[model samples]
Target: MFSPEGPGLRELAVQALSSVERGYDLLAPKFDHTPFRTPDAVLDAVAAALTRMGPFGNGLDLCCGTGAGTVVPARVCRDSVTGVDFSAGMLAVARRRALPAGPRVHWVRADARALPFAPVFDLVVSFGAFGHFLPRELPGLFAQVRSVLRPGGRFAFPLVAPPRPGSPAYWALLGFDAVMRVRNAVWRPPFVMYYRTFRPSDVRRELTRAGFRVELHALPEFGRRRDGSPRVRLVVARRPAR
Candidate 1:
């Protein structure tokens, strides 16, 4: 689903064929018009949830493509905020957008696995970026986040419940992943984005091993599932204060 201003099918096909960085570069200008961008509703909901638990000093948005989730930290942090991503194109687009009235915002182009920063941030948040990381990379990825956070700092992100097996959504995601696998097998510089790899249980265990005390908070915006579990949850993983 995309707006008229979004990339055309031909443009999308070209992007899909390019490396992930270059593909995002081609799409950055029209990213906000595409479904690929994180929605404002989700951002607002995350902001609300974070606001309840914060008055943080400084914040970082890890893998902050187009800075959609940067607003969450800008709302909750007191001093300064930074948005980091590997794509210069995306960072350029993010830099052009006017930020809300909050902390000073800076954009940096850097890989998430090897962030260039001190452990000085009080809060770190990411949205819609986990799919880029494979399951095997979770430990190093979580460690990178932990390394950039101050003692007692938090690394927060929202997770939606996976679609039930046999559901249409389930089939759709499975098919998407299958297609991606086949595409990567035949393509150069694989574009890694999988919808089903980031399970909560596995993530929690990895976060724990990364030295974070993890907690889950229900986001009331999405309500509950039939099984009484929250449809959406904010995973708040804190670095030890000591």
Candidate 2:
């Protein structure tokens, strides 16, 4: 599942044994080479979707690892964009890479659970970071995202539909989660990634409870499943204009 430039078995083994932050810190240099990085296709698709929904003012990229999500906001937002994450190493890599300078990119080191911003953003997006948050953390996490967004602003992310029960992908994810559980049980500072935990129904319900008006938009690029459901969708949750 990794490219030739992605982490080797030894590197992955070391990372799995370390804390999440330290693991990511070590992996950050090679992250873009892995399947772990959000694909450019997804990012482009999301940017297009947001463009149709916006003329957004300022944007925030929640848990913006290496600033990929930040680029989406920079494309769509007119004024400014902020990429926030707790990882200094990740932020360092992001800063090294050239992003559009006109929009005023600001990198902040902060936890997603407690964002360091007022209700100033017209758009906010996160990419591939939800698996770090447990189910119980959704309310507070969504609340934090809502808190940073201006009234009538949006928090958007892309979510792929789950694999079929007997599929190879399904079994692979199941095996991964099982291994993660065992690792966490025996290790310190758990690397929190589980494939099956964040189901669409539960996420939609939690987002609604967190005061977002949730909508699902199919991303035609990823095509459809056998059941005629979308293989991928953009979850656009708007904060009420109160």
Q: Which candidate is the best by TM-score?
A: 1
TM-score of 2: 0.97
Model 2 residue 59 distance off true place after TM-score fit, in angstroms: 0.6
Name the runs in model 2 displaced over 4 angstroms: none
Residue-level lDDT tens digits of model 1 in 1-242: 89999999999999888888999998899998998788888899999989999989999999999987898999899999999999888999999888889799989999999999999999999999999999999999999999999999999999999999999999999999999999999999899889999999999999999999999999999999999999999999999999
- The sequence of per-residue lDDT tens digits that candidate 2 reaches over residues 10-79 is 9999999987788888888888888989999999999999999998999998888888667899989999
Residue 147, candidate 2: Cα error in Å is: 0.5
Span of ten consecutive residues with least summed lDDT in model 1: 96-105
lDDT of each: 0.93, 0.91
